[model samples]
Target: MKLLSEVEPEVKVSVKRIDGGLEVKGNLEELGISEGTELTVVATEPVHVHAGPISLRVAGKETVVARGWADKVYVERGGATVPLLRLEAGEKGTVGTIEGGKVFEDFFALLGIEKGKEIEFLRHLPDDTLVLKIDDHEISMGEGQASKLMAEHGGKNIQVNYLGENEKAKISKIIGGTSLKEKFEQMGVVEGKEITLVRKETPAPSPKRGTYVLAKLGEQLVTIGRGLAEKVWVE
Candidate 1:
């Protein structure tokens, strides 16, 4: 066991309640963390564990958690932290607290994506479309149009490149006159929607033409041009 702030780098610690609050022992102090700081355990394998406020990443090197408030400590697995919705499956957790509620908790609610929500991943279709199953329903998006909606999950900085012929796309955009700040909401793009990327062409130089995303829009795959895709940011 280690103190609340003396844990070694990448050492995953189980959180437990003590004295009406929470406490973590063992090398916790090394990270400048205290008894009540919210920590997101970034990794829990091969002698690695860390807790922090922002996104945590585990790798061959020591695990690191972004420095910040402590509360509702999250547990991680593999190199990627488990989705906050799935953290209830772990043990040996280190307890902590957050001031404005749990970051992970709020993220799912805001996005309308939850752990129990079912999603399907599809690849390599005869029609060159990207298809997915959500809530037991089958949905398909043209490959050209898939990338735009998929970009919503690009927050981890993931990029996609692929295009198909005969696919028509529409630039996903928010109506300029509308007060809504999100294009996804304005365009009716949400979790469980089938989307795909049908093409990747470099239309610019130097910095390079950004990727274009196409998505299936209820029986029609609409191409989302580069400009609109860039404007529709996702976490």
Candidate 2:
């Protein structure tokens, strides 16, 4: 009788019921989580969960994808290149190339990944955490705050979560509306402020489930959210 988000780490729990919309349940099912399914809470401090599905046919390695990161993944099908989100359930394509520079090519290289990034893309973690450095302090934003944040970068307005990795850019503009704007103001994130990417991760494995897309690409298990899974195309 506990919400998945409230469960503690290392405690074994069965999914008695999942309360979400059809798309939420569908995404969970695609990721191999459903009712009557048993899951172990791996780490709750970071809000991370690892459910090793013994029955799942998770072909290869597991690498979590992030949102905003998917826009760069291009799949080759019928001699044409398309984004991963464009494919149907049964359709398949080979991940031919990746754009953005060279920040996240390591994961894609294993699955015939071409090459690629300079930020404007977050790690697209499983839960809804988006971390960034404003000034000398690190800031973590929840899903709602993260999604609502729009910063002026590259001469246009973009999601703060979409800031490029290692790419230092001035906030220039912050469109975090209403309460969201107040949240940023409290944390000292404002227009004309320069933000830098905070990269110090050697992600091992995991995700309890949030807004990610579960993709199986060439023996590699990718759990991407924050709109990033679409960046890594697959066949």
* Residue-wise C-alpha lDDT for candidate 1, range 112-154, written one tens digit per residue: 3223332221111222334433334435533223332322232
lDDT of 1: 0.29
Please report, in order, the local distance difference test score of every candidate based on alpha carbons. Answer: 0.29, 0.46
Taking all chains together, each candidate's TM-score versus the true structure is: 0.19, 0.33
Runs off by more than 4 Å, candidate 2: 1-125, 142-144, 172-176, 200-235
Residues 1-235 of candidate 2 have per-residue lDDT tens digits of: 7565554545666666655455455445534456776655444322122221101001332223332334446667788866644444345466656654454454334322343311121122334445678878988754334443445677865555566666566775543235545657888888778777565333445443444333332333334342222222211
Q: Against the true structure, candidate 2 has what lDDT?
A: 0.46
Clashes of each: 55, 24
Top TM-score: which candidate number? 2
Which whole-number lDDT from 0 to 100 does residue 212 have in model 1? 29
Deviation of model 1 at 140, angstroms: 17
